[model samples]
Target chain A: MKNASSFCLLLVSLITPSLWPIIGHADGVFAFSPEQAIHVRTLAASCAACHGTQGNAMVKEGGNTSEENNPVLAGRTREDLLSKLLGFRDGTRKATIMHQHSRGLSLEEIDLLATHFSMQIRVIRPPLSPQKLEAEHG
Target chain B: MAEPFNRRAFIKAIGATGLVLASRPSLAMASKPPMGRVVIVGGGYAGATAAKYLRLWSLGAIEVVLVEANRQFVSCPMSNLVLGGSKSINDLTFGYEALQANHGVIFRHDTVTAIDAAAKHITMLGGTLSYDRLIVAPGVDFNYQEWPMLASLDAQKQVPHAWKAGWQTVNLRQQLETMADGGVFVMNVPKAPYRCPPGPYERACQVASYFKQHKAKSKVIVLDANAEIISKKGLFAKVFNETYAGIIDYRPDNAISHINLATKTVSTEFDSVKADVLNFIPPQRAGKIAQEAGLTEKDYPWCDVNFLTYESKLVPDVYVLGDSVAAGLPKSAHMATNQAKVCASAIVQLMSGSLPDVAPVFANTCYSFINDHAAMHVANVYRYDAGKKMMVSAEGGGVSISPNEKEAGYAHAWANNIWADTLS
Candidate 1:
């Protein structure tokens, strides 16, 4: 019985590696459990419209962004992200959209967002063309 | 303590690290099996968002099937642009391809016939599907009894509400385009608790902007049932007074008693106003499915739901969100999407035999354009009010100081991002 069980376990391990792509790793990017991936992605997604997708922005906030605006959030220290969000939420920092967006998030959600965004790899984005900008400009 | 949850506890419950590490699979990840089946009805902002996030949080362990009557979801948020000629029907239309392809959310292109709340199953055109948890985000439906003349399915087209988007939007655009110069384009705003509280005013602004540029002599007359503007009151009022003074005529407390379709006139209790193109938006209730399921028992025209989890107070294991639920949150795309996340989180936690976060918080930003080039917005944060049993405006949260031209771009960004967030 012990030998049969060992054989069964070996067979399962062998098959799981093969089925990884088909079942488990199908969403190849997010290997973590759905809940964690979602928790990070969804909260981070709320910032995407203005902050750029996943917190990498070519332009800054307040409809007028210059070099003076902060750098990309990806790969920043967890403490930096948390402080900025808390600043926006508590009115310590001046902002256009972030203040309104960050007002109600609990400290836990803030921590999750900070950890998620800070851990991501920073992405450098190309500038938008005038025509493309026109199309994007509502 | 309502300090909410610690990071370690949340990590332990999801077992996300353990599963990916492929260690502690026997004891840790097994604590909360990721095998709950959730079925959501409707594929609008609320439903689509719930479908996607449910899968995201469950790590695809929970099977989520979205049953939508329409193949393509039309957004009512930016659909108002169609009437003023800034956008087309195609721009407002979205397909379910991404929700299926990217998120692994299953879709059923069919309508729901009935819901068996007790059995936790729903009947569709083809067959019934049972669910461990059923989420109904059916949105809102027009109450046409106020204007009986536009009651029938055929009669409704002649004076389209264009409230639900799609063909009505096209029809309304056609009406506005074909009307003669110096024509009167009249639209009525219903009472509160309707989808998109400031939508009628925004539509009025869009039409006025178009008339100012294209049909110089034409004008838009707004007849509002409510005593005053319900949302973004100061901004909307200011825009009407300064930007669209002559082009848009807004009258409050002018409720519609009946409509004479033949003469193209609307009659109120005290007066009658004639129009060239009538866009009569009717009062709305929870979508027909919710009404049929007896979810709106208290005459509130919406299902009562707990703000934290969005579970139906009337039915066990059946949750409702968006405009269909009597949550104090405004019925806008932003609010609906936020509510959907809260609901999805709670469901996953419940499925895992863990408690949902006690003190939930989210924000809603509503952006409405005053013209093609200019826009305004109101951004407010909301917290779960355990005392009131609903979500209310958090302290120090309110509308923007004023409307601005720069906000137009931000508004467009909002539309672009929100639609992408919900659909893609």
Candidate 2:
């Protein structure tokens, strides 16, 4: 029975290392890595669902800009995005959903997402190859 | 997966790889890598994205198979527009062709029956297949016990939910088309945390939009079980007041205690509504496959997972994404696709014997097209909260306070982009 209890304890520990509090600062344990930065970019691309791939929603294809209400996040520096976010979180800057979204974000995370989006270039589509086009039409 | 590379070093190392990804997405997938088999059940947004990215990030080093019951994917995102007559069912339908051809993902058109997590295999109609890892993104299943009206197929056809975006969507549209002018079209909104909190409101808007154009004399009623509009509260309220005031009759906090299809009446505690058409979107939980696996523990409707990796807490090496995850975030396609990316990355890294990033960042967008012309959205970023072990909201989050026609253009592009990202 004692041996069985020890085995059960070992099984629980193996399955749920995540149940611990010190998430980072350990080996064989989950924490931030370089792959996370890449994964986070895929996360940021979700922004393109609304803000466009460049974070500028008003700007349309072929340099046409719409008279839209939301502000553009493209070409803005990391500091700019961070400062705005801080203001929203602190109630310094007025916003509707921004305040709510910025509520629990640590300063480090705000900087990371802002810095990533700040580096994004505007939209550019590669021309379709003639060979592929012919294969399609034929 | 090599040595313990910290966050900064890993980010810097992946930069050159990112260039290769941009230049040639499928170039890396040309050669198979060391990672073994990964089989994913369900081909909704989450499962599909997981399969595609697992191959992409693994650089074709792994064999990834996606088992989906349906050959074609019907998106719930713009499905409401089908009722409004702005878009068609085919417009939202996507096949696995590109995902198979371009991303090198294997597609199996089969429904998964059971998961033997301990044995690391799944049983289905064809045969049982073993995998190094299993991803379950089966979305949601409706709980139809409260309303006997939805118990029978005939009753379900008359009072369709139209939430899943296929035949039910067609059924709702046909009902609207056949209802007598000046007849009442009533839709009941399930309580909060149902798939797409904004969906019923969006459906109400779509029905009202159709009424304004096709059946101007008809009355559209929205009986919301929640005390208020659950998502995009201000924007939906504004549109209803300005655009759909006369057409849409919205009532809040009226939970339907009984739905009698025999008499075509829906009732709450004391009040009842008789309608020409009834749309009942019942309360929902995780898909049955997860339940059959015994993964839905402690009376939770969804499977509990380490949000960082989306691996089921109860079942090892078995991951759950999409609406099946019991995370606090809105049950949405946007969240599903993002969660899939995180899951895919974690699986690859873990296969290489590396731990996943604990403090991961993610984002979600809740977009609502008020009508054919005007649209609005609420978007937010999220980070892993170690204390709570959940992905909590982060910075760079906001919504459209003053939505317009131009934003409507953005909304359509978004649908196209999300579909391409998930499928292609």
Candidate 3:
């Protein structure tokens, strides 16, 4: 038993040296905790409705806002979205439509929504080609 | 051989102890008593950024307190567009929630009355607060005396500086709105070493462009105090000529000597000009608090600091940053934010008994929106020289010229990025 335990200990020490640093380093970068992740997920549902699954796409038919005016939010950094959201929430960002929507969110909700949207993949459609526009016109 | 315990039991005990020891480091970190308090004055880009970074690098070890006179901060970064009627004041305003929630910084919405540097305490309207380190970034205070006629508070009612964000900007916009077609709008730029050197010119361009579009007959006259305008000179001048050719009359080296508010005219070194609206941005010094703390020279309202560490030369454990420090950098929001980060890191190192390495990279980018679609940007990377005790720009660091009108539009986009980088 003693010899088997010694062998297991040796194996564990060897494995940990390689894997521990990566996990420890990753842990150090998290500014949020596990509870905060749950809060963010709940807050991101409103955005998910228009932005589509995980903020991946814009609603093609239901988006009444002009494309030139509305900014797509997928793939933006957490800090960027938080700042804009907070600005809108506080009435500092000043959008006619977004101001009201942002105001409805609590500060914690804003933070959560920001975190969730920030984690999604950004998908940007290419600018409409003139050729495509011409074909549609015809 | 005799073993004190069974091999399995001994091995399990060791593993549990190792896990405990590994967790102990974080526990030890959490148990450390919070160190000396830091009081940061001003909630603008400089003070706010300093407070956030200080808390960040301290790793929850230091107490940070921010004293701002106003409840909210309205950025001057793109206030010119407000004058052009392109953007609203709401677009420029930002709250202090992010710094408070994310960074654990205490915010005090009160004016700082005095700085008792000898005692390392600051007196605000509410009460006196002590600090282990005090960072002053109260921004610029205009010298109304430079224009004798408009020197008094009553005279300010007639001619507006609109330098500080918010109400002043709104007033200036309202004045522009009421002016008649074919009316003359006069703007005077003070001498060098003023806050946001390119600001007055950008304001002129925006106002002139607006006039050209809405009231083509109205003219905007810019009177410069210096021999040459400092930033984005070629691009701005080219756009001025091509787009609003006759609307903007620019005169360089024409300093305003006096103003007659009753007569509604200005006396410049070149000549006297009468106008419907007069905008004067006077030479400015650091806020009065900086002067009282002995952080400023005569006529200068800022302290001299090691640009790398932002530590004061005259005082210990006190740092001066942003527009209040006589750091050889452009007094832009971007520069202030960068300087704050450097200062925060250095402060952390100082508290930890660790010597910081020299020569940190401080960078700044200033974007000027000539029109709604056109803009220009100047960015530079700077380093501190130990021998000279000064912050100097690295060679090949300067403004990037906009390729064409289309590219200039990116300047407006750059404004969004810059604002996000600093306040967000």
Query: Which model scores highest in TM-score?
Result: 1
Per-residue alpha-carbon lDDT of model 3 for B272-316, expressed as tens digits? 999898888888888777777787777555678887688888877
Residue B188, model 3, lDDT: 87
Predicted complexes: DockQ each: 0.09, 0.12, 0.02
lDDT of each: 0.74, 0.74, 0.66
Per residue, candidate 3 scores C-alpha lDDT tens digits across A20-136 of: 333324222434444454234323422322233245533234423343213557778755676676665554564433454554444555555665676556664321111111111
Clashing pairs in 2: A31-B358, A34-B10, A34-B11, B33-B61
CAPRI quality band, candidate 1 = incorrect
Interface RMSD of each: 7.5, 7.9, 19.4
TM per model? 0.81, 0.78, 0.71
DockQ ranking, best first: 2, 1, 3
Write out the backbone clash pairs for model 3: A40-A112
| Model 3 DockQ vs. reference | 0.02
RMSD, each candidate, Å?
Answer: 13.2, 12.1, 16.9
